[model samples]
Target: MHDKTAAPENQHLSHRTAWLRAAVLGANDGLISTASLVVGVISAGGDAVLAGIAGVVGGAMSMAAGEYVSVSSQADTEKADIELERQHLANNPEYEVEELAQIYRERGLTQELSHQVAEQLMAHDALAAHTRDELGITDQLQARPTLAALSSFFAFLFGAVWPLLAAWLNVTFLFPHPLITIAVGTAIMLILLGGLAAKMGGASVTHGAIRVCLWGLLAMLATALTGRLFALVVG
Candidate 1:
């Protein structure tokens, strides 16, 4: 007999995993992409304010749309799986029970114990039991499309603001060399963002920082090249 008191603890862990994954992914993408965009535009001699605003707005919309589509698909798949499980339970419950029993048996339970466990579980909540134990579906990991979209959009907006601030301050004539100031500020911010993401994800901070910085550099280089080409063509 499982201790009912332990359910909350398990649920909390699952929830943490889901939210943490989404938050980290959102922040990381926001930092990397927004920084890259601003850096690229600045390298091309674009107005800092315009570059920053464009980066923030574009990144937010992209993140929201991408997250919505991805999470919606995930939710759809989960729904389909649950529906299939429901059908199987309705059409061939005996077989489903046997399947559940076999799963328990594989986990070291004796055949008799497995059968009893499956029976008790099915009696209490058949769908929940099969969805969890058999299908490995949990309420915590269930994707909420709307929540995912909102979270991603907001998180990206927040992360993108730092770069925008750098650009805005550059435009205010506060910095001696606005471009250099923006570049340096963006580089430091990217390093910080990467380190934060790595710490959260239990990854190497150095590697993450290097990866982000390299991408930003690449974006700047590409944009600068494009700008020079255009200037040449116009001249």
Candidate 2:
């Protein structure tokens, strides 16, 4: 039996804007930084597990704090803009209407029809219309500091845990070299994380995986080289 009243399956991905950026950035930073730190420590004959743990904790907290402050600043700007719009509407209602109508007219609507549509929309919800069409603020795209902070915090923890776990496994199993295990494991995880993020964002999986893994490997290599140089100098 065919169901004619079935809801539409198509959906836009823009709604993920609030948290997707924070999550992807935090996860990538955490994975690469923690892996690099651990590899460096291992190269320098230091404790890989300890360095991994410290890196994860410090990195996660820093990511959360940074995301919160940055997003909060954006939120403040949005609020100020919205408030300014409110003031303009209160002080000059007619001017605001014509302004909105002009925006519609620029969008291809006829002059008379634009004015009518603007008036009706303003009569219903002037602030919403102006905020969305004029100022480009919408509910889905609005800044939310708390959500961003939490997303980064958890995403960082998720990404950092892999390298830390690899380090621990190497120590526990007496692996020949912690560097090999940690670097390989971190690279694999970064590739997976990149592909997953890309899938969620409707991007190319192969491109994302290769891009993240390459950068992560480069970071770990550079850090490990610095550590080797430091070890040689100190010894």
**TM-scores for candidates 1 onward, in order:** 0.84, 0.91
Q: Scored by CA lDDT, what does every candidate get?
A: 0.77, 0.89
Residues 21-140, candidate 2, lDDT per residue (tens digit)? 557767888899999998898888898898888889899899889989999999999999999999999999999999999999999999999999999999999999999999999987
Task: Give residue 83's lDDT in candidate 2 (0 to 100).
Answer: 100
Q: Where's the lowest-lDDT run of ten residues in candidate 2?
A: 13-22
Error of 1 at 151 (Å): 1.1
lDDT of 1 at 176: 70
Which residue pairs clash within candidate 2? none
- Please give the lDDT score at residue 55 for candidate 2: 88
List runs of model 2 lying over 4 Å from the truth.
1-12, 16-18
